[model samples]
Target: MAQRNRTAQGVLAALLAGTVALTACSPPTSASGSANSGGSTKALTVWLQQKPDTASALLSGTYGNSEILSVTQDQLVSVAADGTLEPRAATKWNLSADAKSLTLNLADQKWSDGSPFTADDVVFTLNLYTNPAVKSPLTTVLKPIAGYDEVASGAAKELSGVKKVDDHTVRIDLKNPDVGFMYTLFGATIYVLQKAALSKEDPATVASSQIWITPGKVPGLGPFTLSSYVPGQRAEFAKNPNFRKPVEFDRMVQTLVTQDVATQQLSSGEMDVALVAPTDVATVQGMQSKGVGTVSNEVPGFDRYTVNQRKEYLKEPKVRQGLLTAIDRVGIIKSVYAGQAKPINSSFTSSKVVKDGFATYDYSPTKAKQLLTEAGWDFNREFVIREVNNNAQRQAIDQVVLKNLQDVGVKATIKPVDQAQVTDMLTKGDYDIFLYGGGNYTADPSTNIPMITCANAFPKGANLPAYCDSKVDDLLSQAATSTDEAKRGQLLTQAGKLENADVSHLWIAQPTRVYAFSSKVTGGVRGGDGMFNMLMSVQDWKVK
Candidate 1:
């Protein structure tokens, strides 16, 4: 295996050197002609691992949605490459001393169709998000907003807390003090839609409405405008003429393809940017030695398996705990990730947030058997691993887990479903267990820790495990509302330790995700953080 890895690394280096040589020798201008801006036109092609259901952030939570929207839509605030909050549509935001209210000063901006963007857009978007019919995952994040419950329960048409002070300013009143509100109003997730164009459609159906789904019908306050979309294939975008800032690339395309295909395309110079699978880390690193492309692999991204507590046999905490101990995460990481990952004892990535008393589930076949027997686990029942077909690394990891389960006298099998059907399966509780892998959207624990709370259960938020503990929920709530940073950290640490003991979710390994950007593409952020932040400055990226 080591010999094959070395050979693969060698081949990857040669391919990258050859691709860079070709790019360096090519003509500057395309055969078509110069752009309307009188500059050499450059087009960027990006490969997304999954096909998105819609470009609208309100309607979709797919992996590809954020990448497209990061460039095609504008939010109130954006996180800078250095992890500081920067102004986008809204120039600045100020939180009241009591932390019960937030006032936002809007920037003088126009939508892509030349319509004015105002505080009304902000109010409308916030109220629309609370509409029960929308089924947005953000409802949990925005729960602290005053009047949210009334709007969510269908008792109110508009959120009374969101007031449009004037054309250029808005204020939001909260039911309780929440210091993490800014991060909750994250850039990639909270896009400001134009009220004039979208208010005509019903809030419930707007996400699926033709006006919003159609590429150019609804205008956006972004650097790029959606020009065309081909389901399961690609989405094309053009530079927004009405954008306030100058854009370097005239056009950009996001194509849906598997990770392997993306790697192949990158090596052949057919693709400019794409994610690298864990198994292919060595290959990409070899390519990076030639300096034709940049490889970024950052922490806080994880791979976990969610236990469907709704299942009768899986409800017992011991069963869940036993399942965790049976699999050797360290061995799997070495085998699947080539020692590029670390085993996570709790949901937190930072040691400071992980309480000293946090529970640990070390690999022990004897202990796993004892726990299962004590919980009266059924050995004959099949342990099905529900996962989609898009990620090859996940499939390889699950196979090892299945073998571990079988070794512990458990019958297990992997059920591969189509990527399109994953949402439905998760919503309907159709699986015994499933693989959940992704990065925390922000460094703030409040943004992700609530995912396991009861309020975030499936059909509303991302709590697919359906593991509810009142103590943990209270700690998270207190942490979210506290204005003191130290207090919040302490509360979150307590919650993490409690949930870890309960085995809410089988916390596995924290992965180092690898992404490759072509040498010609400049100004693209590293993929160490969420993918949204990676392309936050897509408009500034230029081809050499």
Candidate 2:
């Protein structure tokens, strides 16, 4: 594959030549670490249509949950909806002896400022996101722990895959043998962050990620404790009296939903939940025809276009399967998500390589001009794609897929770019296709097999089609270090028959994670996976 796009363009020109001051890759935010809305505690208002500038102190640095106010949800480790792994703040863990390694133990943690959740706060958030001056997005999901690539390339300063076997035990160690390494340590980027509550002052709040956009102290142990988050109003999260309250909810009000006017703010009792859209599920079936609320829909996730094989007519795999037979993934999931999406046949959904009854695309602009005239990629020239900012419904689904690729003659357009220039134009292979969306968290393929086999598909993973195939990267490095669930389900069924017969993603449509709650506020559908799994323990959440 042109030596895999010249080794992912020379490891993304050496990780963007370690971007020594181009001054804009942004990401240093929390907008003043929040909490504090309805005075003396007990709130759970919640509503987030995704803005809090996308909060990610890497889920409170490893396993601390809520970031650090004396950890709770009974010490955080919950992941259910049938994928198992329950017990937050950890009251269990200890695997090794050829099972790879794990060890944890914690029990009744603490740290929302009182300290003592130890192993030096998980080796200080694994030496602060394997620090290169904390350039963390959990450094591409903790770059396969086990000496996190020599402490993220600075040739180890610590973190021989985190060790500390004492102060509340710790032992992680797994550069291989990851049959879902306890389901990727039930993600939230494995939470844990503390090292003396972010070194209590001077430049070293994890060395200035401006201590999350200049907010003061965001340390948590979950049961909500945030004090202020006003970016379009409301983020409050009280009741962390060093938590340990179940049936959960002590207080966790999120509220920031910038309207999709689904109408029933948790059934008109003034905000309890929201995310109805499919043009508001017929205003939530007329708020379930006035009896109140409950709307369950499940498809879960997929909405791709990531065709930057390294630009230019998408480095032709028949122009990325001729823009996946020029979209219409079921007429844009039946008129732009009016049915709230579904089509995707493979990228190996819910693993065991999902193929029940295959054969997907059928929108045919005469079979997308006969697969761009059998791979020569024809007159159809519509190319300018980069928009992700102010996503007016992905600019109205790129103005209806650019009038259906200008009615087959092609020549499309959409340069939107903002949200930090869509994460450095999809990690600097600049962009010729990026319309993205791919959250399947842990339902497998280690999340859609890293969106199709492609070994870190160059330029630091998410393989933007600099797609290589050393036998599908030795069967995706033996399905990521093997835990042998039937030999990692026959190597993810040969990496889903080499990712849906190599259509190399244009799959689009699996979607349904819509969330909205407020029927006198009570938490039930509570997240374990997909459809916000009821916002994964939105903490002691209440209103009625």
Candidate 3:
């Protein structure tokens, strides 16, 4: 997932200084040499901020890895540009009459090594993910599978819910009917791994072994094969000859280029595609005017501040609501984001999945003061708002929040901490408040709403606020298992209202994703969870 960081501003400033010199260099030649050079473009070059930790999709959650892994591995399903579920390895699927089980007809496909892609591979992938030895973040997504607890507890070696009906078919029995189950299959967290290649080794070792990280050694069933990888540097991929469809580029290269340097490279034609930061949207737009192609969309995530309810001073709901009311989210969007973000007022931002009956907390310092007075909160104590040091946007928003709270007779200070420390601080209740943002991975509220649920309260889960509510938990649980869309939406709306009333999170804005590519590169699609799915349609990409 793309993290909003303050370093982007510094990166932009540093890169701007050398933009003239970098652009002064000769324009980069096409992958297929220049028309005058009598060579054909055979490769596409892309810029990523960081190198992936591992090529195995199940082991890593970084978007840097997904850019390469999306082409190198095939998922059971694929998410379309509009966020609809589409078949990939699984050609077609049918839900049981009761909706508690799903049967999928696997495509007649072969791994990059020519081994048959069978139902065994799918079963193995599921079992491997559910294995207690492997601490995969994806374990949560597969928890709905029947017998998942036994499998995760090491009491069972295989998941009873997953069975191979035939060589080309697999059935998954869910403990409860989940409408978002298909979406889970299409997520970057789940991808098929060859059973034959991995079954011999301890499942835990496979994720860390060179056999999985090594470019040519990793078995994949996608349109490309990893040719080479250099940590924190670059990765190279060659087209898979056994791919079901034709791929336009013969090879793809992903180079690690910071946000500051990416725009300069894109403008100078040194890079084919790069994600443009919100601060750099204007610069990229200027490049677009000069024929630089661009793709923009709303990613499935939102920026917000989490109020730590565990704090004595913030234990009152009125204090949380007062703070929320005091902050000017719209003004922050305009000043910090430069009007590049959409104001959000609830936990669920997507209208396609959840309805919009959430309570709104518009900016009003007078109302905030009134609430504080009623709550009997003293205006003398200095509250600390911890923000990650790398995110310039959050830092700007922090300053704005500081000023807003001060105006409401509350003394607040901004505490800048390392990005890595924010989570620990939140988990330990070391901070009164913090600013954070990232995707829920899936559009369904069940995937993200749990963050504020009692079960996920701090130390054990991501409920940074240490918030607990039985009604909210019940609403989310009902929303997850109900097959009725209207009923589910109603449940989610109720859940959102309960959380907003508790002020678990002060909903801010939904940031826009912007990507810049050279005119020669075609077929870019922005899909689920930020830019994780940007290269999901790489097979259709062509360079003219």
* All candidates: CA RMSD (Å): 7.8, 19.5, 6.1
Q: Regarding TM-score, does 1 or 2 come out ahead?
A: 1
Per-residue error at 114 for model 1, in Å? 1.9
- Residue 142 in candidate 1 has what lDDT? 70
Residue 518 CA error for candidate 2 (Å)?
Answer: 4.2
Compute the lDDT for candidate 2: 0.51
User: For each candidate, what TM-score against the reference?
Assistant: 0.87, 0.34, 0.84
Output the TM-score of candidate 2: 0.34
Report the CA-based lDDT of candidate 1 relative to the real structure.
0.67
For 448-496, candidate 2 gives per-residue lDDT tens digits of 4333445456444445556545576678677767666787777767766
Q: For residues 317-379, could you state the per-residue lDDT of candidate 3 as single tens digits?
A: 888888899999999888787787888766654454444555578899999999999999989
The per-residue C-alpha lDDT of model 2 at residue 240 equals 61
Q: Report the C-alpha lDDT of model 1 over 277-381, residue by residue, as the tens digit.
A: 667766776776444465465444356777888787887889999999999998998889888788877665544475577667989989998999999999999
Worst 10 residues of 1 by lDDT: 1-10
What is the alpha-carbon RMSD of candidate 1 to the true structure?
7.8
